[model samples]
Target: MDGIEDGAQPKKKKGMVMTIAAIAIVSVVGAGGGWFLGGMLAPEPLSSDEARVLEEAKATIKAREAAEAAHEAAPAGGEHGDAKKDDKDGLPKASTEANGVLQLDPITTNLSYPTENWIRLELALLFQGKPDVAMAEQIHDDVAAYLRTVSLQQIEGPRGFQYLRDDIQERVDLRSEGRVTNVIFRTFVVQ
Candidate 1:
C-alpha cells in the first residue's frame, strides 16, 4: 500500500508539470502570432511623392498664416489700398481665376413641386485653358434655371444627388461647348 501511494503521487506531479508546460507554450505561441499579425497589418509609410506633397502643403499653410499675421499687424493703407478695402469680409480670397477656376455666386431657388422648399448651391467651373468669367456666369444662370425646374424628390438621397450632379455636368458641358472641363459642386443646402 505504501509503494502504491508513492507511485500515484509521482504520476500526479508529472501530469501537473506537463499541463503547466503546455499552457506556457500555448501562451508564448499566441502572443507571438498576435505580434506578427499586428506588424503585418500595420500601415506602410507614405511614399516619396505623398510626403513631398504633404510637406509642400504644410509650407504653403505656414506662409499663408505668416502673411495673414503680417497683414493684421500692419496699417490698413497700402499700394493696393482699394483692393484691401474691397475685401469687405476680411477673408483672404484665393486667386481662383489664375488657376483657371471660377467660383460662381450661390444660387438660391425654390423647388418646382414644393415651392416652399428652397435650395442653395455653390459651384466652381474649371476651364480647359483660360477661365471665361462670362461663360461661367452663363452656366451659373443655366444651373439656377435648371434647379428651378427640379423637384425636391429629385435631389434627396445619394443616388438622386449623383443624378443631379450628372445632369448639371451635362448642362455645363453643352453650355460651354467643351471648354469647361469640370463642374465642382462646393455646397448644396436645402431648407
Candidate 2:
C-alpha cells in the first residue's frame, strides 16, 4: 500500500509540472505573436507640419538654455564701472518666439492640497499665425494660478494627468481666444 501511494504521488507531481511548462510555452508564443503584430501595425508616417513643429521645439529649448546661462553669468550690479548689462528687466533674454513657436519659462509651484509636493512644468506653444508673447505670458500666469489650486492627487495617475493637460489646454484656448493654436507640454515632474 505504501509503495503504491508513493508511485501515485510521483505521477501527480509529474503531471502538474508538465501542465505548468505547457502554459508557460503557450504564453511565450502568444506574447511573441502580439509583439510582432503590434510592431507591424504601429508604422506611422510623419507629416510636414509635425516635422517642422519638432524642429521648432528643439530650437526653442536650446535658445531658452542659452538665455538662462547668460542670465546667470552676468553680474547683478548695474551701477558698476563696467558697461551696463542688457535686460535690466526681469525677463530672460532668450528668444521666446520663433518659427511660429513660443516657449515660456518653466513654472514651479506647490500643490494646494498637499503643500509639501511640488510640480515643475516646461511648455511650448504653437500659434495659428505668429506667436504672441503677451498672450503667452498671460497663459503662463494663468497656468501658475491654476496649478496652485490643484491637489496632488488630482494629477496623480495617467488619466489624472491627461485631465490636467486637457484642463490647461482648454484654459489656454479660452484665454488666448483661439490665437494660441496648441500647447506643447515639454516637461512635467512632480516631487
Candidate 3:
C-alpha cells in the first residue's frame, strides 16, 4: 500500500509539470500571433506617386513663403514717389509743398539724486505736406513744458519714458491733424 501511494504522488507531480509547460507554450504562441497581426494591419508605406505629390506641395509652400517675404521687404511706391521725384528734378512745381522734419533738443527736467535725472525726450518731426510749421513748433514747446511740470517720481522708469513718447505723438497728431505722419527721435539721452 505504501509503495502504491509513492508511485501515485510522482504521477501527480508529472501531470502538474506538463500543465505548466502547456500554458507557457500557449502564451508564447498567442504573443507571437498578436505581434504578426499588428504589423500586417499597420499603415502602408508611401507610394512613388504620393511621394512626388508631397514634394511638389512642399515646394509650392516654400515658394509662397519666399514671395510673401519679398513683398514685405520691398513695398510698392504709389503717387507719393512720382511727385517727390519731380520736385527734386526742379520741374514746374504746382504746389509749394515740401517735406520737412524738426528735431528737438533733449532737456533734463527732474533731478532725483547726484547722477539720476528725469530726461525729457523730443522727437524729430517730419511731414510731406506744408502744413502749419508754427503749430508743430508749438507742439514741441508744449511737450517740453509738460515734462518740466512733472515730478521726478513720475518720470523715473522706462514706463514713464514710453508714456511720454506716446503722449507726445498723440498730442502732436491731434494738433496737426493727419498731415504729420511720422515722428522720429534724433537723440535720446538720460543721465
Model 3: lDDT to the true structure: 0.64
Please identify model 3 stretches exceeding 4 Å from their true place. 1-97, 105-108, 111-120, 152-158
- Report the C-alpha lDDT of model 1 over 1-191, residue by residue, as the tens digit: 99999999999999999999999999999999999999997756779997887688668757966876787677666565445342323433345555677778778788996675678898989988889878988999999999999998899999999999999999999999999999998889876
| Candidate 3 TM-score versus the reference | 0.39
- Residue pairs clashing in model 1 are none
Q: Which candidate is the best by lDDT?
A: 1
In Å, residue 16's CA in model 3 sits off its true spot by 99
Q: Assess the local accuracy of residue 172 in candidate 3 as a C-alpha lDDT between 0 and 100.
A: 75
Candidate 2, residue 153: how far the Cα is off, in Å: 0.8
lDDT of 3 at 70: 82
TM-score, cand. 1 vs. native = 0.54
Candidate number of the best TM-score: 1
lDDT by residue for model 2 (85-169), tens: 3243333324434356777878978889767567889888888877888988999999999999999889999999999999999
| lDDT of the candidates, in the order given | 0.83, 0.82, 0.64
Using lDDT as the measure, what is the rank order of every candidate, best first? 1, 2, 3
